[model samples]
Target chain A: MKQTPRIASLPPAFGSWRDIRPLVAVVSARYRTLLQYRAAAFAGFATQLFWGAIRLMILAAFFAAATEPQPMNLTEVVAYVWLGQALLGMLPWNVDADFRQQIRDGTVAYDLLRPLDLYSYWYGRTLGFRVAAPTLRGIPMVLFAMVLLPLAGLGDWALIPPASAVAFAGFVGSLVLAAMLATAVTLLAHISLLWTISGVGVDRILTVLVTIFSGLVVPLPLFPDWLQPFLNWQPFRGLADVPYRIYSGNIPPAEIVPELVFILVWTVALVLLGRLILLRGVRRMVVQGG
Target chain B: MPQIEVRGLAKTFRVAERLPGLAGAFRGLFHRRMRDVHALDGIDFDIERGELVGYIGPNGAGKSTTIKILAGILNPTSGTCRVDGLTPWRDRRRHVSRIGVVFGQRTQLWWDLPVIESFDLLRDIYRVPPATYRDNRDRLIALMDLEPLLDVPVRQLSLGQRMRSDLAAALLHGPSLLFLDEPTIGLDAVSKLAIRDFVRELNRDRQVTVLLTTHDMDDIEALCDRVMVIGNGRILADGSVDGLRRRVRNERVLVVDYDSASEAAMLAAEGEGVRLVERDASRVRIAFDPERLPAATLIGKLLAQGTPHDLFIEHPPIEQTVAELYAEHDMRER
Candidate 1:
């Protein structure tokens, strides 16, 4: 007699991956959706470039005062600011208001039914956006920064490749770490919905804190010595400022290896914490107003 | 062994009780009160493989809670439940792989993507084999007549079209068990009929185990071979549709029109549990138990007594029957 394999006998781990598949599915869908609005995407890219040029002009003026014949130079300042802004755009910030909206709108009911861990789904989706951000925001900024840098007469193009590779790896790792921490924070905040009617204020405050402390607006080295210690230890620094330092060569290659190791450690810790928070939050879900 | 087994399934929710009005709302922020709600209390049932069961209940009667527990969305406070030999809450990922759930209020379809794109995504989600997926996808699309709507974005689809697409998407994985929660809640008559017919065919032809919860009696009457009624955190009744109907089978109504009240000779038909309502000089309505007096004999006796114009017999409406049963069990006040 011939018999087909029973589903029960199949590996259980296969089921977990099957559920995670939708995360990729959703990202691909989002990409196709963004393609339909390519004109808007390009317009966004142009706006980012304009902003980068403004920041470069100010940094160049500062460089003129600092040293004879440009101390920091145009290329370094422009590339540094350009990558910083692009990395800022790619960092994990989707959970700021999205989780609150989902809880309020009752759409979260569908999300709960999915077989995959909800946090992983959000992580994978954020990865897609980060990948997409480089194309839409980073590439254009790099081109504009290159064009604007010749005033300093210092194009050390040879330093670009290794620096870019290290920076890319660090940025991706940092984004993963940021996303994990952000997801965990949001999960805890989302549980507040059970206690509070709204989480908008809390969400806004968290975003503002991330922007200020993560060195997205200003460089971390510019902060006071006392605050520098705090930034180095916190997960936010790895998410944004640490990667920006590597990209601008503020931190040498010898310094980056340890930073990468630290970022990896933060990523693993935050993901585990996020999973635990999600487990606790789901058990306490009140399912308001059907 | 039963394909689905539930023993003493109970779920209690701690709901934050909010006071009404502006002043109360302000006070609630500082000092809040929580009330425990027993959504499901001691529910037990067994469904064999290939059984099409209708789980009907009134609003907040734990219909959704039971469905969620069985689908592995929420864990019960206590008790045991297994779907296809796996504890749903413990082995959720693996258990869910064998089941397909469709919430009519929600769309599993990607709103911005075309219907076919959503199907492709689900194929990846369930990890359906390429060949098996092709066969199933083609068959479902054809069965649901979704070829014309394939390329249209889900946001542009009508409720009927989207529902048809949702059904197709859920089935792409070829799950052995299917959970449909209010699958026909707010559909036009045509769409409702299409959904009901497809569900019937899915159960009958595919031998799939179906557990459907609905407020619509027609959905219950049309699809389910066995029906379970839930009320106030408990299973009120579980039986075949005929058996449920028999539970509250006391009243039979008959409408009769006569030539004239005087010619009907006082129209004093009494005894053997008959209550006459409305003597409008021409027509008379009687309520009685058909078991005690057969309709044919009663009508013949009525005709012998008076010259009739028309007569019709009707069993009580399903809603009234259920309401009465609920009241009998003291489920309405609670």
Candidate 2:
């Protein structure tokens, strides 16, 4: 019998980006998806602007009520609040929910069969969002804030170019911490579903805690005396408060070391916890007859 | 060399038991019950390179559990599986690159993107080189007839269209081993035949190894050279389709149009192990196992004994054979 030649050869190593080729492909696809709905993107940007204006109005009221003449130095406060809101929009909540949804919907089966590492895939996609979401809303919010303030104060804005650079790194750290914590929490919640049909209770509790403790609405520093100590030590504070404080210069660079260490600790701890839950939970997955 | 090997594969799951009613629900908030479900139990098989095997089983009979384990999704409780000398679960990332899997009910394609976009994303996901990706994608698109669906969003495609796209997607990376689980479910007859024809060509021409699990028996009859029946997480039978047919029953039906209905009834009574299944005014059909009495022998006997107008003999469909096998093993519940 004659020999049959193989048409295609396997990749040298699995899940390794052989070249810049595949990464570019994944980024391009994600970009095209976000651009597909023009109206939705516009509406999202408009919502950010509307909320930024409302926050600036509240700060303006505080300046008006001040007793000292320049007690009303509202420029820095307005810029900070606007930038904080924009940064808040950039952070992602693991949607701890997709974990349960994927398992329930059988989509996890499809994802696992793919060659790429699940962790790497999620990280790439979330990084893509970090880039896309911030640019879409952040740039406009800054532009709007610039129009409302004077070019004189914009002199201090020279600090912004470097400040933004430092802010970007700190922002990324915040997203990673949030994603890892949510993933860990989601894994914990999802494991319970192996025994219970409903994961609603756990899901609601997680969302509520992340929202209040992560400082999405109010700054952690603004919390009452009784709550400040508890919020300071929790992982939620590291996600939003630590990063924002670093960005606004509320905590000087010299003080960032401790916050960075805390965030790193949380990331490592949550990753270990997520992996443990997955290893243990999978053994109990009982896909019933369909 | 055997490309795929399995020995004593077993999997078990601990299921939580919930109480019923308002009182039971409130009482069970603190305490919960647990139960164990055995999915796959001691399954063993070996397939050589490029062998197309059909794995058939009733629902929850471990067909999917075996597939999931082989695909590296779920770790088995005990036992082992190796494909291309790599344990699937232990080294999943490397193992998955060389194999392609398509689940009939799910689409790997992203719903919001066009078919081409999802393919591009998968190229990145598998890290396929651009030159190779272009060539392989073009070949699959042509072979699977997906030229028209490439620009369309996956959500908008018809079930038949999506399945065709999925098949092309699975082959885009040019994997040597392919696992197709219920690939033809809910497809129209024309689409089913097209898919079967394409898979047959892929196996015969490209030598891609295939392990298919399907509820549709026609798929097995049309494509598979060997069939493995699994029940209660165990391999019940493994052999050629013809061998399976013999085990169930080789019953062939003889339909006779007789000059008189009475003569047909009289001839049917005279024959042993031949019973009349249905009859009209001038036509009668009788079922008899071909092994007990050969088709030619039975026909000759019937013709010699009765004055019939026309007669023909045909075997029962494969569905009946599989049903009988399941019934014999008491595996119908699964």
Candidate 3:
């Protein structure tokens, strides 16, 4: 065979610089694809806005009935609710519909033929989805809540700025870490499609679990005093509740490092666990046919 | 070493058996029944570099299973397969980086993206250098006439156009071995011919080894120098197209247009081992085993019997030959 001189002459193993190019490309390509759906973004924003208002009302009613010295004051509770609504896109509650379709239709065989690492490829792609969904829909919903809450006589329940420069940095750090952790969780759910053959059940289960344990439906601090420690110890809390708590200055300055460490540990553990599961799933798929 | 090699390569899938009714389904959940389907059973083959080999079989005859294993997407249950001295399943990343695969029924391109964008993404995925990527991309676009379709999203292109773009996408990395699984399926005649011509040229000029699996007999006849007929999870025949034709049935049909129906009938009965398979007004079709009687002798006998206005010799349809081959091996039952 006549080999292409340039290709044959190139080094067999990719350099460090070359290795990261495809990962970056995958993330950017996924982000661009999400941006192309203007109408979908608009619909998503509107839906989240409506849900944010409903959640806010429910929180307001509960706070009104509570006695003084509640675990979270009305303002902190309001911010937490709005943050949950905003970061709803970051929760890995749903697997990528395209990926699920590929699995169902058997086109995932093409994925196996590619040169990239399957886990890393999916992780990068899901990271883009997690980041893009929030940037497109959640930010608008958050901004809407900031203006709508105070006008309803909700005790100036607008978003409270971070307490310090260090706190602001911590908020950003936690949010990024949370996104990575959510991607790992989503990877695990997506890989389950290999055996389950359908993602609907997995998606529904993940949704309920995330809604309850991630503090999306209600703040973890308000999940009854007895259940607080259990909820905080779970990995689901690291996805959204920890980041929101960090952003709302709920974690005191002294304990911020430990909480951040706690989130990091969960993120690393979930990622490793996801990678291991994906390897086994891929081996089964290649050997046994999915 | 051969460019592609398979020795005792086999793949078995454990298929869960399902019951017929609701009660059986419930019982099945508690006590599942599993059956092993041997998709590929101890198949062996080798193709030298730069060879265009046709791997053909009836549906469920393990053609696709063999292709999947060779392409590095599926692992065989036992034995060994090496492509360019690399074990595909063990060294997948490096193995796949050197080969290209196209499945006619499924596309690898991003559906919502422009054709050019998918090509660019493939380039990045394969880590093709910028200069070489551009060179191959431009050459393929021109060769496949894909320039006009470059800006269109994949979902918008017609099947033929989409296939052309897919061909270009698969070759953008300058792979030395290309595995095409029904690449011309569902294409119009013009598109099919164009794709066949392009593949022929690619294999001839670039010396790229091609392993094509297609139900299209024309594709096999037009491109393959060697054809492998697989059936019942095993190879039944392997040789040139004409060699296969001779092995299956050494028969030739002679169609004679006579001046009168009586003359056609008289000629049909005059020859030995020549059976009249069909007879229409003033036209008669006679089937004769070429091994028993040469075509020239049969023509001479027809002339001796009566004067026919016109006559020509034709081989039995290749499809029928292949079908008989399949039945002889009990491919359907297996």
DockQ of each two-chain model? 0.27, 0.32, 0.38
Interface RMSD of each: 10.0, 10.2, 7.2
Report residue A266 deviation for candidate 3 (angstroms): 1.3
The DockQ-derived docking category for candidate 3 is: acceptable
Candidate 2 structure quality by residue, lDDT tens digits, B161-218: 9999999899889999999999999999999999999999999999999999999999
Q: What's every prediction's RMSD, in angstroms?
A: 6.1, 6.9, 5.1
Q: Which stretches of candidate 2 lie over 4 Å from their true place?
A: A1-40, A64-73, A93-100, A129-132, A148-290, B258-269, B302-310
Give lDDT tens digits, candidate 3, residues A121-197: 77777888777888887777766766655677754667766667777788888888788888888888988898897
Tens digit per residue, CA lDDT, model 3, B126-186 = 9999999999999999999998999998999999999999888999999999999999999
Q: Rank the candidates by lDDT, best first.
A: 3, 1, 2
Best by TM-score: 3
Per-residue CA lDDT of model 1 for B197-301, tens digit only, reads 898899889988999999898888888889999999989889988778788777778888777777555667787868886666777778877788878878878
| Local error of candidate 1 at residue B68 (angstroms) | 1.1
Candidate 2 chain B: 10-residue stretch with minimal lDDT? B264-273
Q: Report how far off residue B193 is in candidate 1 (Å).
A: 0.3
lDDT of 2 by residue, A108-183 (tens): 5556677665544543443454445556666666665555344555433222431455656765665556544443
Per-residue lDDT, model 3, residue B98, is 95
